[model samples]
Target: MTGARFWDMVCTALYLALYAALYAREIPVPAKRRSVTMSDVAAHAGVSIKTVSNVINNWPYVTEETRQKVVAAIEAVGYRPNHTARSLVTGKTKAVGVLVPDVSNPFFGTAIRACEEALVEDGYSLFLCNTNEDAERERYYLEQLLSRGVDGLILWGARLSCDELEGIVGADTALITVELGEEPRRSNHTCINVDNKGGACMATEHLLREGHRRIGHLAGPLDRITSRQRKQGYEQALVTAGLEPLPEMTVAGHPSVQGGFRAAERLMRTQKPDAIFCYNDLMALGALLAARYLGLRIPHDLALVGFDDIDVSSIVEPPLTTVRIPQAKLGRLTGKVVLERLRGSEGSERVILCPVELRVRGSSGNSFGEEQKKATLDALISSFSDGGERPA
Candidate 1:
């Protein structure tokens, strides 16, 4: 063979060798796995598939020995029940739906957790939906949840009227609505009521007892029932003290920090009240910032009070004095009510009311002296500088 022919053959051999090495280095793709089935478990347990089905569904007639055998076999075979198939046979999805105006809100978050805690014990899962306080969104969520065959629904601060709700909800799905205003004329569902009026009164009364005469109110959106009820309570407190509830002293805004800031600033700039009672904790936080911006001292120049003793309420600059809603208890109660409705234990639809308490803190002027306030503020500042740990 010529030198050129020998060189070409050598190069081809080298190329083939390199390609084989690369292919060997590559990881092989895994094949699709077959799921473990009830048949496999039944075969392993030496029992009929019908017996396995009876054990899974808790049919109450399976012998304990057979049940243990099937369970052990299921564990060994790694069998997972088909939820869709089981739901079809039982006609129950074993799920609950929860609709809230704002899921990000701390109050709702606490309530949701509490409700879920109560529900999960009974083998029920939760489907959470955020409506964002929109009527159309609320309707869409209701439709979707019902379509998924949720066993029950818990609605918090929904805007849908009773007629609208009745028209949409079927008889099979149990509903428990939170803070939906007055008792419904129709009685197809249960209502959970919180004492917004009484809670507001408590906040206002606390400020009054602290000797704040020219007290003002930073109200939430007037359209919301909670906001209106809170404002009414504030007015009632003022009237009970033989003081007129002036329109200028009561300002309405969105139930948000920005809304509170704008409304509080406007109210302070024009009316110049000594103290302010806020609609909720979020608005109260805004009012605090507004007070700082307007060169007002908290509790010294402009005392403040808020509703909804959220977690942050206790950790703010001087801490906030606000009305506490007992959200965990309320949530657990809500879950219980939903369960009762699901079981058809109640003869008629009814309303349940939850109570509230007032937590006094530094911002209310009666608690936490100047030195302790300074120490708390210092600790909070240090916590951020030292790895963002919360102060105990």
Candidate 2:
């Protein structure tokens, strides 16, 4: 053979040898095992497929002996019925859809995790959709879930009207709302709620008992029930304390950091409230930053309290005092309610109201010092009336 041909033959032989060695080292693919079907189990058990189906479906008429035999056969074959086929027969997908406003929000994220865990225990899966708090987007996702045949839905802070919800909650589809209360006398669907009003009242009353009569509120948007309820609580607490809820003391904005900053700025410009209660922790954090930038000492100059005791709330400077809600419990309860409805229970929809509590911390400090309490109150009142130039 020529030299080049000899070299080429040698290289090819080496390559083939390496390929064989690699192939020998690799794990072999096992033969694909066919899944055992109902027919196979029935034949082995000496029973008809219909009898086996009746046993599987838990129909009342199956003889106990026959049911035992069929179950044993199923166990022997390790048979699992095709869920899709079973769903077709029963007209139930055994699935729940969850629509959240913002999955990234810690509260929503925790809730979704809890809901998934709870539903999985009942042999149901979760189909999650993020609506981003957009009414149009929420409606579109709702219709999609319904069209895809989810057995029920859990809507987080839904913006839809009673009429719209009624149209969707027609026969066979169960609906539940989380973190939002039902409108007056509207009783079609179930609702899971945190006590927004009570939480706000506790937060505000905490400030009031601490001698913060000139309190400000960094309120959330007026559209949501949570925002509105918290506002009501704040106003009620002030009235109960015999103090008017001054218009200059409250500013409405989004439930975000920037929103809180803007609202605080407005309050600081008009009248420096002795304390501020934010709608949520995110807003409270923003207010905190604003207070720092304006050279105001927390609690000493302006007490700060927030709702939603998220993890970060404790880690922030001064360790915010806020209201803690059972976010995960709320989600788990909602899942259970939906699962119950899917299992053929029917009645007036349930309303599960979760409780809330205030977590005291440094932000809402001892406003009433032995020597400074009266002086601080006078200073706060003077600050409100002075109309002094606000921080830029």
Candidate 3:
């Protein structure tokens, strides 16, 4: 063959080879998978869309066999019911709002977890919002929850009054408030109060029995009804014991560790109470630290007591003596009641006072004036201390 003919054939072969390789490397784009819908499920199950809707909504009229068929078809097609559309048809969101003062606080955290679990068991979603004990923040969350059309609300330590809540919350919405205001009857909501006064009275009486004549209280914010109730109980117990409830012995704090530390130091320095009762476990923990820093031994030089037996209370060097409020039970009960209201089984507006038990631990002494030699408090201090010095 001639040189030109040979060159042209070679180039043609190379061109064909390159074209084949390029075509082999190209990937065919797959078609987008359409989202599986209730319509698809109905079609797959050989049932009407209405049947599928009824089944999804758990309408009791549907036959068990038909429900099974629809459920099987849903599994086969991986069809997810459109929650928005379902909510629109049912006029229910199947969502509950839980507003608390502080989520970071263990007391509220445990309650929230228990409440969420209970709600989830009934196919309801929980929307959590922390108000941080601010009225404006609480109002904002309330408005937001209301706008979202939540079917129910569990307000813990709510700053808003029942009238304010009723103004924002729809009449159809179920409301449950934990540790709220002193209003006897909201007539539209259920209130759950911890026996703050009774618990306080018990703590004071226990200290009195221990022979601690001078007992100081590191109280929570006075504006909060829980705080006031606790203060009242403290005073009642003191009066009952033939002891005067001196104003100087009561110090209002933020109901936090730091607050407790400051309030405790002030109380110890000025009032010099042989025994101290704190509003909650957190404050008591703080008071414990303050006592250690001041070189006073627990149950010896100073007897300590607290409320709300939180988890950390037991794990401390000396387990805290506190009033157990059954926080988890409170949460579960709140969820149960709210669910009942949602199902139209509960309609009466009432107040529930959950019982509190006193858990006596090493913090409080068995008898007064006992000189017990305790350890140097180095372990607990090192665990939580910020390595900061006490104020001069």
Model 3: weakest 10-residue lDDT segment is 368-377
Model 2 CA lDDT for position 208: 93
lDDT of candidate 2 at residue 237, scale 0 to 100:
95
Tens-digit lDDT track for model 1 on 260-347? Answer: 8999999999999999999999888999999999999998999888998776877887798888887767888889888887777767
What is the TM-score of each predicted model, taking all chains together? 0.83, 0.74, 0.84
Global CA lDDT computed for model 2:
0.81
Off by over 4 Å in 3: 1-32, 184-187, 346-349, 366-392
RMSD of each: 6.5, 10.6, 9.7
lDDT (C-alpha, whole model) for all candidates: 0.85, 0.81, 0.85
Best by lDDT: 1
Q: What is the C-alpha lDDT profile of model 3 across 105-141, one tens digit per residue?
A: 8888767777888899998999999888898999999
Instruction: Give the number of colliding residue pairs in candidate 3.
Output: 0
For 153-175, candidate 2 gives per-residue lDDT tens digits of 88988887656866866755877
Query: For candidate 1, what is the lDDT?
Result: 0.85
Whole-model lDDT, candidate 3? Answer: 0.85
Q: What is the lDDT of residue 182 in candidate 1?
A: 61
What TM-score quantifies how close candidate 2 is to the native fold? 0.74
